[model samples]
Target chain A: MSSTEAQVKEKKRGRAFSHFKSLVMMQLKDKLDLSFLTSTKQLIAKVVFFVLRIAAIIVAAYYIFYYSAFFSIFAIIAWVPPIVMALAFSIIFILSVLSCMVGLMKTLFFADDNRVLVTMPVTGNMVFFSKLVVYYLFELMRSYTFTFPLFIAYGMVSHLSVGMYFWMAFVLIFVSALPVAIGALLAIPAMFVYQFLKKYEPVKVTLFVLVVGAVIALIVELIMLIPENINFINDWPLKYRPSVISFIESAKTYILPLYAITEMLIGTYENLTFTLKPSNALVFLYVLVTIAVVLGIVYLIAKPLFLKMTAQPFEFEKKEFIKAKENRKRRKYKSILRKEFLLNLRSSISYSFLAVYIAVPILILLLNKIYAAMSTNILGNYMIYAFNLLIILLILLSSNGIVSTMYSMEGRAGYMKKTKPLDMTFPLLCKIFYNSLFSLISIIVSIGIFGAFNSSSIGVGGLIMLALTVLFFHIGHMVWSAERDIMNPQNEQYATTGGEINNPNSNFMTVMAFLVSFAVAFFSFILFNESGVNPITACLKLMIIAMAFAAMRIYLFIIKVRLYYREKM
Target chain B: MRKSVVLTICVIYILSIVLVGYLGIKLAIFDPILYVQSIELIDDPYSDSYKISHPPRYPDQDFVVKEYSKGLKFRLYCKVMPENATNKEVEFIVNMPDNAVGKLQITSDGEVSVLSDDFDILYAKVYILSKDGQKARSRDFTVQINNFKNPT
Candidate 1:
């Protein structure tokens, strides 16, 4: 009521608004600007990638909506709208939260300007608040992209009103907030744990990756087993797994907050269209209050802890270099290969790439197990197609992009590679060899896992053909990426707003090349192998094709290396 | 320029998905799926008597033969292809329980029947072959019966 107090409040509001705006601008400039694309190739790749991603989302939405309508007729008879919506919304919510958690971690503790912000006249709370605001904006875009199609599909199916559409839009904005808050809460502790284990970086990274991979495998196993178990629930002889059923029941109870939102949405629409269900409105109020209280609690807890947690740097003791005896006598190329491996292991990003290398095959193997389980009846005829497809997918996906950014990852240190007193193409060969180790390991593991579990044998001859196919691809892809990077390397030390590095061109080319290769491999397999030809003969022909491709890539890569030297001179 | 491109992509993506989704809805609602619904055993008293007298439940409920019927008579259920499409070639191959006595028959109108002389819980598999490349096979259907030997 006092003019003086009003002015003070107004200034504070103005200051906060300005801070959020500035922070958002900073993020856009540093991390999200399209100018970071640099070249036309990268720009085109980004555009294509964007289109493909949208297409996938559209396809997924179409299937979900189609199936939902099919089941909704029965669901409506059962009057299970609330429960159905809850499960759907919760699954999507959980997935979104998991995805956003890494981004939250980047924003909260690892932002590039954190050190400067701490020393500024502004309070830590202000800085934290600004960061969260920026994070919310990002989450909003992501949440909209995912949820909008679902909403459209649902609306088209359910024949909802214009008012409901507006209400749904309003509700969608806050849908991501719960997930983001949860991610922040989890990520902070994870950061602390990461800092604690910083001393044994290599071992820690390995363990972390293994642990994550195992968790993924376990989740997948559960997903595969749950449907089968549920199917057997009514069979007296095949008694339902009570433990899993109970765990699912408990999980439903725990996800009540998400259930509440779903209930409110459905209830609001129902109340408008049909009878006045007082319980629906009551549930809506309850859910709103719960969300507000939970958010308040999170804010209160995270405010002070954010500064302290972010300030604590990861510490590792320095060690003096000591000359060690040669472990083994190795050739020059082998030594170069070892060096490349060592460099990749030292950096977190490169190590993450390695983790992908190890994790992909295991993931594929688990999936193959599920695939094998599903096709128990049609195993004899289907095995041939499945095996070839699996091998191609695994080799193509695993070996892809790992070596694309190999030289770019060196940043300024690429000059060292250029000036090295050795054959230029030898280093590139070493890089390819290093990548092949991963590809070969993946292929062997996949073959072993599939062979051990499935009744059908991928014969020795088939294995040899598969190996040759994979080897050619791995070599061909690695050379392609290395050549691309050598021709137009991303040597700049570019840092995003969140202390993340982005090698736009190399990363783009890497992914684009892999996708193109995958598409070609897929169609080629479908054409040559699936045309009623004998599978062995088909595979041999495919191997010959791959070999020719590999030979061409190898020749081109050598030419690129020679061109690079000539240009430098 | 960038924003327009993004907008175009988003528009194209949404339209394509909607189109496909609409098509999917139509398919799910209207497409007639050919499948074997169920198999049944015709009741005969002698077969029931024999099965009840036997202690070990050799023929489980799924394959149980309650009556001693001389021959197996099971109805075939299929959703035919589109009405306009004529001359749809359909064939049925039955693997009879007693390979020696069982015979396969297809009427002019594409009716399939299996005739057998003697049956003591006979298991037969019905395989459907169609010209349109659409196939459906029934699970092993069991028939329980024995032709009574009079005064032998």
Candidate 2:
């Protein structure tokens, strides 16, 4: 080979190794970075704050463990079923990482970022690795937040040996990595399919991927709940030891890396003086085979598809233009409402996220039903109420992001409203109307699902409660957007970088909005009962009150927008 | 930076001392030695054996000896009842601390009553009386007792 070509090969090799090292460093840096403690004074303050928080948690945990009988009962009751469920979910969760990759690939490669990256000298693998890292980081954050506490509690309660502690730590780290590896394996095929199927043909491909994904999820759920249904299966082999063995074996296969790390930590090999039986091997083998088959199928489908799709040239066809003549001009409110609804429908990502948010409550309710069937005493009406309350809280907490992002989503394109001859109130009204509508939809869907399960006075009460919550959140959003001056409004399209912001009024406004909403909900509940009204009637009254609040909010928005229009950027 | 380091070290030291003092107090207060004592059962002369039923009339009513010891111990008991009784099995159980290891002994008055090999006695001793009456009175006794050890 020519010296230049040889040099190119050597550079390529070095680049690959450097990229690997950077990825590892990035993950390590994320964990170790203490930049949040910049100044000495700030560091001290943060240390004190963190110490207090940790101490509070420790004190609470101590009280729960030592002082509370209720906590003891709760711990015992929660341990087996919830832990098993969590474990099963984790396994399924591992598999779902692949589906997430498929979803991400569809979003990223077809997204605006792909256009920017495609022209660069970077190879497909580099872009792929970067996206994989991002997705993995997201998964890690979520998994650790939810699961690590439980694991730590388990260790402390069990008084685990040093070996066990090390094993658990290793398993945690391995488990975190497992999802990423699975995501990579899943994404490669997905990207290939995306490459092959351009021009909405990929929709079918994506749907197929999703269907397979859903089926795998369903299977995992079934497997996780298999022990609960052990009595139902009549087969002799499955009736006794084999079923348990098979389940464990399957668990081990997908999570062998985790198991390996755990075993190492626990000194499983050294401790096993007696005959130690390993059961999950077959299940593990099945998972491996399934992964291989799926990969093969994706590759076979993708190679031909990528070349064909990429070769195709972009074309735009002109159609005969006909414009509908304006009838009697509709009311501005109706026009604004229509425009808001259309905007949401046009943005696929927003619509999809909204759809998922709506669907989640219903899915939870269905799962509750299944749980009730399996164990009626454990999953009862009280759980239903708690779940509804949780959903309401989530919707309320999430409203800020959804609504604030709506303002940000406007981008520079929304600046034209300033030049328009229309009243400043029109655009402001439009934004608030759209945001409220979406929030209303989410609230209604969640409450509707909650109501479906409960279907009682309490359910009606909960619906009323949530309606008030949604209204409060909506009003809060209106006040926030109106007051908080946006510098480089285009940056809103991106996710918020820091938890804090420059606007002094923003925090005060949010706090006030939340307190007012809470008070409104509380008073409405009290007044309804005091008046001796039926729950439905009470809810209707609350809804009317909420709408009145929305109306007041719109009035405030109009004033704010006028001020905003006059104010310097 | 030096002040911060010193402060951090001092804080850690204070915390360590507090933790150790607290733990020391806890250990002293909850010391197993304070609570550990021999559980004594006073012998009652009023206690007498009576045959309630032949084929185990009540599930809860078992011929149980009160307390038993740890290892290498035996208690011989003789019992006499009606001749027509078909059940000849005597149940022996031992109640001790979770860590205690022990064995039990029951000697019948005649060949009518026998100890079952299958019984795994850990908590209580049960004796089944057979109706081979040779006029024998059964008095329960325990030997080689050990102090109950706390697992913690």
Candidate 3:
């Protein structure tokens, strides 16, 4: 071979190696970016934050476990709903986090970047692998945040071994990612159904039928529990033995991956005398089938659907009269609010995410009722109190997307508002009001449902407590908005600018909001008791307080809006 | 379309109220309680004997016997407490029913003794004496049972 030809070949090889290295580096960098530890400072801060959080959780767990007898009595009287609720919430937490990841992935993968990526020298496999790696890392970080403390608490209380801890860590990672994988795989078919439904009005009727069918099924299950024939299942021991054992076996086999990890950690076969059994083989089968199905669907269906969704142009059908009217005033504030609401409501991902959130609490409530009915004891007021707390937390969390998107949703259209003839205060108030209204409605609906089922137990006082809590929360959210300077609109058109900027004061604002809201609620309770007022009267007082706070928030919002409007974009 | 959606929601709200009312009425009308009467205790060489009976006022109440002889076991009478009694507190008055002739031993606040001949109380623990003079039979009539030996 000629020396020139050899040199050209060597250069080509060198170019190929460099390309591979760059690809690997890009993948690693993307993975790191998605993690909580994006930088040295972030890593240090997160570690410190997590250490403090974990220590607090450990202390709490120690107290609960060491003083188990007292809590046990409460647990017994309350029908163990809190423990069940904790478990349920953990499941929902996992699912919700995964849904968010899926939403993020869908947003990123389906965006205009796909057009550029498709024409790159990169193979389709390479692109999918890169996305998957990033998604997996994202899920891992999220799961760690939510579940690490829980596992640590569990281990400390249970006195689990080092092997057990390792297994737990493995199971947690896999189980957390399982939901996202499953949801994404399922979305392919869901999307197809959605497309089919989009063509016809019968989709609404079909959904109604499905909901009715579900309710009917629930009613049937409730009826079955009350039947004389089924009473033996709760009563007879000898007859129930096989069924109970088999049910546990089935749970270990098919449900949560934790079962397999637990068996492995505990050394199931070694504890045969204690009635501990091994079902790892069965679990492996279950996991295998699940992975196979998910991967197959992703490869065969998801890729095609994703491509189709991206390839298709978004068709906007506008009513001519409405469009003309909208153009006449060019009320940018109204337009922004409209866009935000529509985006949330129209997006399939958001709707599904909301559905999961709503369904989970309702399911937990129903399950609790069933358990309480079957047992000798009744669920108590404290259980209801905790449920209210959970509902409030959920409401707060759900508002995150809305609040985070508030400034970003403005796009370039917000620039017009700054240059408009109208005062900036008007537009800002309108934006805050729109968000507040949505938040208020959700809170009201959730509280109303809780009130309906638990009216006799929760009483008018509970309703008042909820109302007051909601009111304070709304004001607090607005305060957060102002203090965080979340109103300075950012254009999200460029990918690089999408990263969240750390405002050190955001933490201080969060703490202040929590402390202030909690103090007010606690003080109200004390006053209600000190005055010897009846619950209804106390509730009335709370409602008055809530109204006062709401009024104050409105005034503050007006002032902030004017100030923000005067500031440059 | 928006107006119709709003109207539909209003209609659903009205229906929910009516439905809840109807269900409440139905539950009140069909109030069901399990029935329990007198408990019979059989005397055996292997086991002791005891009996518990309720007045006819609680006709619908039933008792299901659960014997945990080795641990905490007692004859549980599963009737609802009186309406006036707070759920947090229970006050019981025990009396010896007719037909049984024996000096009953009474225990209150962990203090045990035979019922005083001078005082006749509605609530007392009845204890039957054995031939050997060692205490053999006892029943806690007024006290909540923490643990008991099953004589089934």
Candidate with maximal DockQ? 2
Cα-based TM-score, every candidate? 0.62, 0.49, 0.49
Give the alpha carbon lDDT tens digit for every residue of B54-103 in model 1.
Answer: 22555443332333343334233333333222323445455555544535
For model 1, residues A1-569, the per-residue Cα lDDT tens digits are 89999999999989977876776676667567668379998899888987787667757766666664553322311122334456767888887777656776767766657766666556677778777666677778776676655655555555556666666677667665667667766666666776667656777869887888788778667645633212221232124323433444566688887766765554433311312257656765665665577657657876667686567663543454668977886786777878878866666655555655555556555445444433232223333344434444433443355456666666666777766667788886776565567767766665555455543444567556756766676667767877877777766652112233454544665455546445654555464435453456656776787798789999999887988787896
Ranking by lDDT: 1, 3, 2
Off by over 4 Å in 2: A1-89, A92-96, A99-152, A170-177, A193-198, A201-342, A352-401, A435-510, A532-548, A563-569, B1-92, B95-152
Which 10-residue span in candidate 2 chain A carries the lowest summed lDDT? A268-277
Q: Write the per-residue lDDT of candidate 3 for residues A508-534, one digit (tens) a residue.
A: 444444454455545554544444424
Which clashing pairs does model 3 show?
B34-B62, B35-B60, B35-B61, B35-B62, B36-B61, B36-B62, B94-B122, B94-B123, B95-B122
Candidates 1 and 3 compared by TM-score, better number: 1
- lDDT (0-100) at residue B12 of candidate 3? 35
> Per-residue lDDT of A1-569 in model 2, one digit per residue for the tens?
99999999999999877875565455446545667656898788878986675555545544444432222232211112122233444565666576667755564444444444444565555544555556656667555554444444444443445555444454454455455556655665677666566545658668867975696577546634634322221332224434543455466567555454333323332111111225333333444565566545544554334333333443543444669867767676676667777776576545534544554444444444443333222123333333334334333443344344445456555665677556766665565565556656766766675565556545566576655755565565555545343322533333344222333333444444445544654555454545452455555555576667667765666676677677943
Predicted model with the maximum lDDT? 1
Return whichever of 2 and 3 wins on DockQ.
2
Candidate 3 docking class: incorrect
Reference-based TM-score, model 3: 0.49
RMSD of each: 16.4, 15.6, 15.9
Say which prediction, candidate 2 or candidate 3, comes out ahead on TM-score: 2
